[model samples]
Target: MRRDDLYITVPSLFRCPISLDVMKSPVSLCTGVTYDRASIQRWLDSGNNTCPATMQVLQSKEFVPNRTLQRLIQIWSDSVARRQLDAESAAANLSVVPSQEQVKVLVKQLDNNCYSSLEKIVSFAKESEENREFLATMDGFLDTVFDFMRNADSDIKLIEQVVKILDLILSKVSEKKPLLESSCLSTILLVLQRGSLDSQIQSVRLLESIAAVGGESKLKLAEKEGLLTELVKSISKDKDPRLIEASLSCLIAITMPKRVKTKLIQFRTIPELKNLISEPNTSVSTIEKSLKLLETLSSCKEGKAEIWHDSVLLQAVVQKVLKVSSKTTEHAVTILWVVCYLFRDEKAQEAVVSSNGMTKFLLLMQSNCSPAVRQMSADLLKIFRVNSKSCLSSYDTKTTHIMPF
Candidate 1:
């Protein structure tokens, strides 16, 4: 039993203001304030001169050990640890298993469409990991919830709670085959189209989880009417970073099947994804997913044509190589490779050289990129050397092996 498991409240005097944890070795600065030695040292090392608690500049860097606070913290920790151990021992003796009758009553309440019953169900699921596991094992529990969601008269608030609880239960349950085949998928998709922001986010996450376990169901999800369009619209309209990320992730999952790849292109997903990549404030993870999706889209001729037709999109794709993570660089280079090799667009080749993409490619080869990236960069350089002879001579290269055409 750890001190964190206990319900005891630690005294503020015994805790460090910086770390917010009980101090093992208390120290005081010239400002007449006390902190843990390590915490204050870190604060000072980070170039902060003002005391964290007092906000006063320190006259000196010297600190004196506070033996009194150290003793107090140690005593309190021991007392908390003892209490935690006793609590754990008593809990072990208590049986927390829900009887068969209780399970029947909860299921009945869920089917009754009572708001209080739904609230209790959600509370039971969150009370502990044990309750979640127990709920997953109940027969027809998920089906009952899905049926409630599919019914038209189900209250919006109740549906939102049910979707959230289903999200939780699905995360814990290993067998999600039932969800992929259930009518709930269309209901969730409808929620994605019309539900509130919270419900929309949850619906996207639920779809993402299902897509993770790819099968025929992934293909079915991709073919679902209006699903891809809704996902694209979500990305374009939502300002919340979490919602954008969830939407992008869901798009990536559904597009895994080759049949669905063209569906995204038809929905005009390329321009939206390119816009996201070019956004100055977009997060790194979102950029990575966008790049990955673009890589997938480039596999088809329509994808290639859509990307090459836009010079800004082509330049952005080229500039991404060696600009972000190694994986991102690899994906970026893969997009370029498809354009320059598979599609063989003359303007696209020229755009890469104009964007200083040739320089980035050469630098990528010299850098510590993955072997696949190095090979792809080398292959792209070869294409530039052959097709764009005048552009190749602009860069100064010492190696004769990479001479200008």
Candidate 2:
């Protein structure tokens, strides 16, 4: 409709009931009342959008000032802004306000959802050419966003997001060198310690990432923090075996081969941990987890020492599993099988001979028992014969990887 038509047709709607004039500000009403722009805008923003006097319903979307009206409002607003700037300039006796280039930069950052564009922002932060102040601001922005992400629930994706946060943190530590020296490193560790089971598990996986990025000093710092032992212990005690298995796998993956033996030995993990491998009656997850821990522990040179150790830890581990009245016979034999295989390794063979481990092997073979026991005895006997430089081969060589799996 034409302005004139609107004016004529809507005269009553425009007039404020109380003032009863030409409705100077084009007052609106609901249920026989009137309100100004501020009140109406407040109501609209709150999702109410109702006229006060007549209680007339209003859809906030319908109140747009079209091209002509908007242009007029902008002209007035620009004049007001210009006057303020002029006044500020005059007070400081300067031609213009100090550059608010910062506002523009922040606007761009907010406009592009730049926070979610993690890699780009992080790489930009790393660039030497970027203004140092700008980098600082960008870091603050990213930190805000990361803090929000840390609130996501404990689903897999949430954990994955935490991993992303951790990776970015690691990247910062790499580039900044002094970054992890701050409280953020401690905070990151705390989050990993307390995150969901899956997140906790991935926290273990981050070991290798940290190893890759963290130099020797930082690595020792990590060790001082006791994170490795904490990670393994968390998995080792988990009721869900897969988590334990994953933890061990990642631990092994991250550990340097040379350091593995010492670390495991320091933790006293050899035989006490090894007993879980042959757990036949347990959930496959449990059995699998035990095997994985064993696998990782055995990957080092000192693992050979367990088989031939004068400590008899290996015999004790196998015996512990055999002693379990809960379906452990197969597991026991499997333990023996693993010991035999390790014995074939020259280091282990030498250790065994030095330790006189052969005496126990002979004893198990001679023990009178069920045929299954005899069969296992014969298997180990054949293995000893084949590998022993001894005259008689007791294991038939057919049943080596033969666990009850």
lDDT of every model, 2 decimals? 0.77, 0.46
lDDT of 2 by residue, 36-110 (tens): 344455666787656654556754323421233333433454455466556644544432222235433543564
Q: How do all models score by TM-score?
A: 0.68, 0.37
Q: How close is candidate 2 to the true structure, as a TM-score?
A: 0.37
Q: Give the per-residue Cα lDDT of candidate 2 at 349.
A: 40
List model 1 lDDT by residue over 267-305, tens digit each.
999988888888665778888988988888888888989
Query: Which lDDT value does model 2 have at 320?
Result: 38
lDDT of 2 at 284: 49
Worst 10 residues of 2 by lDDT: 1-10
Single out the weakest 10-residue window by summed lDDT for candidate 1: 396-405
